[model samples]
Target: MEAIVPGPDGEGLVETRLRGWVDPASALAAFRFARHAPSAELAPYLDHHWVVTYADLAEPYEQRIVSHPTVNITITDDFRRVAGVIKGGFSYTMRGSGRVLGTRFRPGGFHAFFRAPVHRLTGRFVEIEEMYGGAGAALVAGVLDEGDMGAAIGVVEAFLLSLEPEPDPLAEETAALVSLAEEDVTVTRVDQLAERAGRSVRSLQRLFRDYVGVGPKWVIRRFRLHEAAERIYQGRDLAGLAAELGYTDQAHLTNDFTAVMGMPPSAYARLGLGN
Candidate 1:
C-alpha cells in the first residue's frame, strides 16, 4: 500500500507534473497518466491508489458516476497510447476491466511503479505478467536487462528514500490541509487554510487545484460526504448521522448525498460501505 512519489532529481522536479510513486520495498506502486481530458478529468486525487481506464467515448457521453478523490479501474475495448501524470497512494488496484494488461518499467530512464520482464517491457501500456518486489529489486533486474543507468537508478532511488518527509519542502502544507479538513465537516474558509499553511490564499488554492485536481472547498465537501457515507453505511440512523456530520437536517444531508453518490443513503446502506 506504499506509493513512490517522484522527487526533485533527474528531471529536477520539472513543473510539467507527471507524478508517479513506487514503494521503496515495492509493496505496491501505481503508475498513473493524467491529463485534463473530459472523461479523465472526473477522476480525482484519491486517498488510496486506483487504476482506471483510458478509451475513446462515443457520442452522448455521460460523466462517470464515481466522485473525484476516489479510485477508478478503467476498462476499454481497444489499445490506446495515453499521456498524463501518474500519482500513487496506499492501495492496490482492486479490479481492472477490459482486455488491457499492465506493463513493465525498463532501464532507459524509466519510472515504473513496479518491475517487469525485459522482453515484455515495451513502452506502450499493457499488463505486466510479472511484478518486481520493490524499487531496488526492480532496478537490479532492469539493470541486468539493460546495462545503462542501472547505478544511477539505484542512487536516485536511494536519494529519494533518504530525504525526510517533512519541513516546508515538497508541499508539506498539503498534509496540514488534509488533516484540518478530515477532522470535521465544518466548512473552512480558504483564507483560514492559507493562514494555517503559511501560504497566500491564492497560492494554496492554486497548489490544491494543480496537485489535487480539485479546489480546496470541493475537497472539503467530498471529505465530509465520505464521512457521512461511512456512517450511514455502518447502520447509523440517517437523521442522527446527518446532524452529527454537521448537516442542517436529514433532508439537507439526503439531497447532498444523492447528488454526489447518485443514490440515497438507504440504498447505499443496502449496497455496501464504499462507493
Candidate 2:
C-alpha cells in the first residue's frame, strides 16, 4: 500500500461560491473547508476527500457549486448517498451548524464499486445501504457521530478498505483522457480527443458512456464552458473570449451559456461585478 497524502489547499477543481454569490464574505467567514488526498491504493478510483463545516453561521448560507464530470459519496446531517454527475450548477444551503464529509470519486472510479456502466447513475443518487448493506449504515452512523474530521475520514477509509475493489485499467485511462480535455484548451472537439487517445470517435464515445457517465462531446463542451464562465467573471471581452474558448462567435457562446447558466454572459458579469 502507498502512503496517504493531503489534498491541496484552496486549489481544488471546484470553484468557490464567492465567485457566484453576493455578500459571501460574511457567510464564508464562519465556514471551515478542507480536502484530503486518498490513499495511493484508492487514488485511481477516488479524486479527493472533503469536509465542510458551517457550525457558526448566524444565517443560512446558500452555496453555489459548479458541476464536474465525477460522481461522489456525500454524508451530511440529512442523508448519505452516492450522487451522480450533475450536468449543471446546484445550490446547497448551510444552516445553523453542521458538517459534511464527502468522497469525490474520479470520472470513472465509481465503476469499480458499481460494477456497471456509470451512465445509469447520471442525474440521480442512490442510498449507501442499497449497495453496502448493514455495514454501510454503520459507517455512516460512525462518521456522523465522530466530532473530529480526521476520525470521520478514518471511518470512511476503513469502510472502503473493506470493499477492496480491484483495479480497473479502463477507469485509469478514462480519467487521464478526461483530465486532458480539462487541461488542454486546444482539445475542443470529439475528433481531436479521439485522435489524441488513438481511438475512433465512436470507440471514444462508448468508453465515456460506460465509464464516465457522459459522452466525450459533453465533457469537451462542459470544460470549455467552465473556462468561459471564469473568464467572463474576470471581465473578459465576450467576443474575444468566445473565440479563445473555441466558440464560433459570441452569439454561439451566449446561447450555450444561457442554456446552462440560465443567464447571458453580460448578466453573469454584472453579478460577478456586484459581488
Candidate 3:
C-alpha cells in the first residue's frame, strides 16, 4: 500500500463553502484537501468524496471548522465514524503526518442511508459499525489498510453502493431547498424561503427537521455567514454585509460569526490582513 504524496491543495480542488476554516490561509498551509464526486449510482445521496493529507509539520496544528449542515463519514487513523451536522463549530488537530478519506453526503441525502430522522445524528459522531454493523467495520478496516487514497475511496463507495440508496422525492426537494438557501443571498429568513418553496412556514420546518437535521433559519444564516467571512476577509464593510445578508444589525451578525469562528468579524478581519 503506497500513501499519497501530493503537492499543495489548490483552490480549485476545494469548495468555497470551506470558508468555515478559522484561518483559511493557515489551514491550507497545514493540509492538502480535495473533493471528488461519487459514482453515478450514488450521486443522488452524495455531495462528493473528500481526501485530506498532511505531513512533516514541526508542531501540531489545530484547525477550527464552522461546520456545514451536511453529514460526513470520515476514515482516518484517528477515527472512523459518521458525523452529523454540528450545530456549532469544531476543531481537529493534526500531528506528525496523517490522511483522511471522507464522504460528504448532500443535505437531506443522508436520510436515504440513515434509518431514523436525520436530527438523531446532529451534534453527534457514531462509529460506522454502530450504524452498519459488520459491513461498516469492514469499511473502516479496508480504508485503514489500503495505502492508495483512490482505492481507499473506492472501498467506501462500494460499501455505500451495497447499502442500496433509494431516492425519496422529499429528500430531493430538501437538497434543492438547501441549495437555494446557500446560493441565494437575498434569502434572509426562513419564511421567505418557505414562501419561495410554496409551503407554509410550519410545513417548511417539518421538512427541514425530517431531512436537513436543522431548521431552515440556521441553514440560511450559516450560508450567509460563509459569504460574510469571505467578504470580510477581503476587507468589506461589516455594516454593509449585515444589511445585505439579512442580519437585523451588525451585532447579530457578530454573534453568529463569533459563535462559529470563535472570534468576531473585526478580529477575524485583522488576521485576514496578515494573509
Candidate 4:
C-alpha cells in the first residue's frame, strides 16, 4: 500500500494508520486500503481521501469501525451520501468484489460546505443529490465507472472545486482546537481546552456544537479511548493506563471502554494479541 503524503498543490496521498480493528493482520490481508490528500484549495475543508477494495471471497469480511468527530462523503457500488458522526462502533460487511471511496472532512470543515449548523447533521445521512443535484449523481457514476484510482480522485477534486465555499475562519480555529485534543493526552477536560483556546467553557461548547457537531468533552473522551485501545493492544497495565489517561480509576476506564467497544479492555487486549 502507498503511504499518504502531501503532493504539490495538495494533490498527493497521505499515509493512514488503521484503528479499532478486531484483527488488524486479518483485515489487512483481506482488503486493500489507501488514502489521498485533497487539492491544496480543498485541504482546509478535507482531511483526506480514502479507498478500500477487496475481491469476492467465500465469506464476507465484517469490519468494525470506530467513531470520529468529522463527517464523511462515501461512494460505493450502489450507494452515495454525506454521513454525519457515527456515535459508536459500526460494522460494514465486504461482500462481492468492489471498491468504496470516501472523503473525511476535517472537524468543523463541513460547515463551510453545508452553510448550516453542523449539529443538524449529527447521526444523519444526507443524499448527495439533495446537495449537488444531478451533477452530484453524475460525479458518483463517473467515479464508479472509472477503474483507475487516480482518475477517480480527479473526479472528486473537480466536484469540490465546483462548490468552493468561502473560507470559515471559525472552522479553522475549531479544527486547531480539535487537533490539540486528539494529539495531547494531557488535554483531558473541556475547561483545559477552553483555557488554551482563550475562551470560556460555555463559549467553547457553543463553538463546537455549531461547527463540530459534538461537544469538547465528547471529543476529549473519544480521543482518550482511542489511546486506550492502542495501549491495551500493547499490553499496558490497566491501572497505570487509567491514571495516565485521566480517568478516576481503573473501574471508570473499564466502564467507558466497555460502553463504546462492547467489550472490556482485557477482552480487547486478548483479541488484539490474537490470544
Best-performing candidate as measured by TM-score = 3
Between candidates 3 and 4, name the one with more favorable lDDT: 3
Report the lDDT of model 3 for residue 184: 92
Candidate 3 structure quality by residue, lDDT tens digits, 1-275? 01232423443433434556777776777888777778899999999988878889899999988888899999899999999999888998999999988899999999988967999998999999898999999999999999877788899989988988898999999999999998899999999999999999999999999898999989998899889988877777666788899988889889988888898988989988887
Cα lDDT of all candidates, in order? Answer: 0.39, 0.80, 0.86, 0.83
RMSD (CA, angstroms), candidate 4: 3.5
lDDT of 2 by residue, 116-197 (tens): 9999988888899887899999988999899777778889988887887889899999999999999898898999999999
lDDT of 4 by residue, 104-195 (tens): 99999989888888888888888888878998999888888888887888898798878877788999999999999989999999999999
Q: In angstroms, how far off is 257's CA in candidate 2?
A: 1.7
Top lDDT prediction, candidate number: 3
Off by over 4 Å in 3: 1-17
User: Where does candidate 1 stray beyond 4 Å?
Assistant: 1-65, 68-170, 183-192, 243-246, 272-275
Worst 10 residues of 4 by lDDT: 1-10
lDDT of 1 by residue, 1-275 (tens): 12233322222221222122211122112122212211121112112212233233232222222232311222223322221112211222323322222121111112212122212322223321223236434433443343223243343234223322122222334544756776655644667667777888788767664434446666566566767766655567665666666667889888987776667877867754432
Candidate 1 RMSD to the correct structure? 15.1
